[model samples]
Target: MTDSSSNTQETDSSQYSVLNVNDWSENWQAGKIGFHKDIEHPLLVKYADKLTGGKSAQKILIPLCGKSMDIKWIADQGHTVVGVEAVEQAVLEFFTEQNIEYSKETLTDIPGDVYKSSDGRISVYRCDVFDFNRSYKDKFDAVYDRAALVAINRDDRERYATLMKSLSAPGSRMVIVTVNYDPALHPGPPHYVEEELIPKLYGNRYNVEILERSDSLEERWREKGLTYFDEVVHFLSDKS
Candidate 1:
């Protein structure tokens, strides 16, 4: 996922802007993606059963997915994985580095392109997440929101949440992983997401539950002057 803007957290609602796609592209081009993890996220692996509901061939959506290894992992489990990303560089790197043979085609209904794995199990849409709309309404059975929500600007959350809802089918489940820290210390692509914000975003359509919270402040964040860091996991079940 592309986390936009400078390191300073913006408090004024008026100052918040839509994420910068070019910034993300630049990051990818320059190899400035420290946010990219080498392995599957530990939290995601820990809670895979909940996301899949012990079922196979479920349709899954990953928003702002930046070549996440989890996409390949989930697809290997016999599920269909769909990822939405903005930067072409990240998308290409994903397939090339993973050694997955893929084909690409431009999307007629929307801007950007779609890349599909030869196995037909994984597809990644190279477009801004916001541009992907209700055309995919009720398409996914579950969502894995690892870096998407936290990477978004605060002002766009409602729109983002609504988009998520529009894409998900009835009874769909979502697993979210968020990193929390004092915004005063450092601005973030992985911004501090307040616990209260979860319900505010999804309460109308989903039952939200706090699954776990742990101290996850890495040494780098500590060196950046953050006093504390908390990583939280949330589970959401559609109300319908």
Candidate 2:
């Protein structure tokens, strides 16, 4: 007979499905993520000044920041880095992989543990994205989106944009890296967000610019029986 524990594990893995904090926790437990990179994204390095509005020190927000190396890169540049992620496992991995010491606490008005750096430059709140409180509105000087946007399903894109815009301080800047592709050819968690949708999403409140586009990941997608992510970067600024 097949092991009952194995069957239960498989069922939980697919059932939660990244829709909430519990789901992402399961995702990490199963090691299903392949999008993680140990190095800072080249696009972020190229446009760091633009993202921070040429400021060396600014408060930055990164959503869905899995154990990605980009956070370490930005923090090392002398800016405060605040990231929100759903999985505690991923948060721990970040500290472990980067060799940074952190302490965890159960914070009020938030649904998950808050892992904070020893020196206070980095903070990762482990919580469902939507559960973040509105009291944080207009609090960030800049926002960075590498894999955050395309990682979510399409139905939540509007809400995601609205939340990001609400958190912008006056004249705040944002650098969003997204994937665009033929939706029919891929199973997309890194979903295809068409170019036209950017304006519909953030144009009303922020000035938008298309900075770069590439097919560097095209071959990787083809290997997976799909086309490509067709990576694109966009720069956005608050109108106010």
* Best-performing candidate as measured by lDDT: 1
How many steric clashes does model 2 contain? 0
Residue-level lDDT of model 2, residues 156-224, one tens digit each, is 789998988777788898999888766655545676677878888999988999999977564567776
lDDT of 1 by residue, 6-35 (tens): 433457532233447887787788987877
lDDT for model 2, please: 0.80
**What's the lDDT for all of these models?**
0.85, 0.80
CA shift at 78, candidate 2, in angstroms?
Answer: 0.4
Q: Looking at model 1, which ten-residue stretch has the lowest summed lDDT?
A: 7-16
Which runs in model 2 stand beyond 4 Å of their true positions? 1-20, 134-138
